[model samples]
Target chain A: MKIICNGTEYEVGQGTTLLHFLAQLQLDPDTVVVECDTEIIRREAYEGTLLAPGQNLELIRFVGGG
Target chain B: MRIMVHEQEREVAAGTPLSEIAASFPGSDLFIVNGCQVSGAYQPREGDGCWCLRKGEMIQEHELRRLLSLRHTPGVQEVISRAVVGIMGLGGLGSAVAGALARIGTGRLILADYDIVDPTNLNRQHFFVDQIGMKKTEALAANLRRMNPYVDLTLHDCRLTAANIPLLFAGADVLVECFDDPVLKAASFRLALTDMKTMGYVGASGMAGFGDNNLITTVAHRPSVFIVGDGESEAKPGQGLMAPRVGIAAHHQANQVLRILLARAGMLMGL
Candidate 1:
């Protein structure tokens, strides 16, 4: 299955969880907030939430600002 | 050729290189060359005509005004030509803070504001009557640039919403929170803390009313969150800050910022 992460397409195995995909991409889970199809996925559900093909994911990183 | 040193007149060979002029000053630790402070490893070029060098007791340029005046050492002017600081507001406190920072030679400034200058802003804002209808960010940027021509000013004439806050602050080393609204202040604080968690960025708050002067204290350990002014002090609707009081707080904020930068560079220690 394929999914888009940060504007790049990634092919992944079936039944892949968001956390698994993020781990496969070598991204730091703590510093990023994951959004699936414009909806924020809770941190606790990252391990359980499954990703299907063609899913859109946005990873926003927090930066210092005022 | 004529050169102004310590506001006095002096003559050097017309074609003297700046590096040769700098090398002529023996035992001097720093040099203010051509309106920019520099030290160590800067060689003057061929076109570098005679330039002013302001230092102590070198009266070959001009007669000493007074013994006390001769005793006074002009603070070393160190210009950070690459620094980029982001200010969140253009109101009373932000105006004073931005002006002070610009005057002190913060080379780059990014100002963000979504409002328009108003008549009431004349009381404490750094805006003229003609700027009343102008966007606050653009007006403040113009005012700051007019004060210092070397400043590279960018005006983000838009509201700082959560969606764009990270992008706006990505390149800044320090963030100054000058917004007055409680909701906006809280949001900014949260954003700053989150940023600190991810990246090592310094930030500070406070500088609104007059009575809060006593609350201006710099936190020792976490310089990232230097909360100045009384956190508990609240501003009443329709009541704004005065110039003198806000000016003092802004000075403190700028000092803290300088200290933080110096510490990061290993030049300063122990607050």
Candidate 2:
């Protein structure tokens, strides 16, 4: 399946959960906010949401500074 | 009964007294029910529009209240005075933003932070030398009250999160995201965009280095999300956050907050 994460297109195994894909990218679930197809996916529901072909995902990672 | 709190609607007991209502809003001293100042013993009536006056703003005579804001034009000041703004973090950006809004006569302020004042924060964050050991909320509220006693300043002594974001920020017309961590900042803005259900939200990003004054801009990520920062200057080991540059970004957030409030009130100039 082809899913775009933060404007970068990536190929992942079919039926991959949003949580699983994020883990493969070395991203922490708590450190970023997830948005799928313009809808914000809550932290707890990331594992339940399955990515489809051509789906758009946005992972916003926040940094630490004033 | 339904009554307007700060600017949002709230429900309470069948005959909730002004005192009880005032207590829910931390640091509020005078309650305004239907545009009239009421005592603590007064009970709210149906469809009453209630709000609080900051400490030391209790004037028995309406004429005196008018005299206090005599310098500001009556037309726009009314809208500004009725506004309630929330500051999520009481650090450099949060403190400056709150102070600016208070000086502009924003009616109520909601401030949250669990951190305490430190000598290092003196360079950028707004705090007095004598306030080093106190909680940020306590120190900031004290300083804000001194700046504008007429502005109700509510303080929360806990670290803010997107959890229950709506309830925590329900009373404000605008919520300013001012956390030190980028992750918290993003989460704060995301909640405002998706969870506010009501009220405007402003956030900062990439306001970390110096010398690109014009680059520190306010960008509208969506119609609902507004960012105030250079969008490129992240603080790294080599680069640093200085007082002047941080001040600029803080004021940018403050100015954008006012703009959002004015636009909502339909009093925006040249719009």
Candidate 3:
């Protein structure tokens, strides 16, 4: 299935979970906020939140210092 | 013949001038009576409803900054003066942002920080040597009060979580994300998008290390979420966090905060 992450498109397995997809991109699940189709995916549900085709996700991570 | 000013009835002679009363309140030249801007010389008639700008209690320093702010942005200082902004951290970003906001005549602030001033924070954070052992919110509050005694402040010396985010910042117009941890920042952002939907949020990210200054800018990813500073300058071993870079990012956050505050009320004219 194809999904848009931060304006870029990518293809992943059909049943890939947000947790797995984030891990594949080297993004730490504990350190990033994920919004799928404009809905926030809580950390506990990341493993069950399946990414559908054409789903748009915004990933934001905080940096160190102020 | 009863005339109201800020809900207070002032006993004056029938022919007493408005300018006389306006002069009593520093920075209060323009006043509205019954929805119309009246001249200072205009005398109030019976049953007049009036509101005076900059009528709040102010000290000398508060009046000075209020004058400068009103001069720089006409009709804006009052709105900002009545607003309450939440500062989530008391380190580099929160402390600097607090000072800037207070100096600009922000009437009230809701500050929450559990950390204490440490020697390491001396490098980039806003703290004096005497405040090394004091709580972040406590020390910053003292400094702010000294700078502007009239500036109201509410301090929350505890860790902020999603459960308490709504309650803690219920009255704040905008929440500034200045946390240094990635997980906490992300968690706060989550709460900002959900619990605090009506409130505007300005967050900091990628403001680490002594990287390119030009790369640092505010990105409005969402209508309510604006991230300041470059999104790549994470503090690593090679590139350490310098005071200049931290100050730059912190100022960017402050600028965004002012814009959001003004824009929220539709008072931001080309600023």
What C-alpha lDDT values do all the predictions have? 0.62, 0.78, 0.81
Worst 10 residues of 1 chain B by lDDT: B61-70
Error of 1 at B204 (Å): 5.8
Docking class for model 1 is incorrect
Where is the poorest 10-residue window by lDDT in model 1 chain A? A57-66
lDDT of 1 by residue, B62-164 (tens): 2222211222222223324445677778787677778877866675777888999999778777889999899998888888877665567877888886568
Q: Rank the candidates by DockQ, best first.
A: 3, 2, 1
> Where in model 1 is the C-alpha error above 4 Å?
A1-66, B1-79, B196-208, B237-239
Q: After superposition, how far is residue B254 of candidate 2 from its true place, in Å?
A: 1.0
Q: Order of all candidates by lDDT, from best down to worst? A: 3, 2, 1
lDDT of 3: 0.81
After superposing candidate 3 on the true structure, give the runs of residues whose Cα lies further than 4 Å from its correct spot. B1-62, B269-271
Write down the DockQ of candidate 1.
Answer: 0.03
The global Cα lDDT (0 to 1) of model 2 is: 0.78
TM-scores of chain A in all candidate models: 0.85, 0.90, 0.92
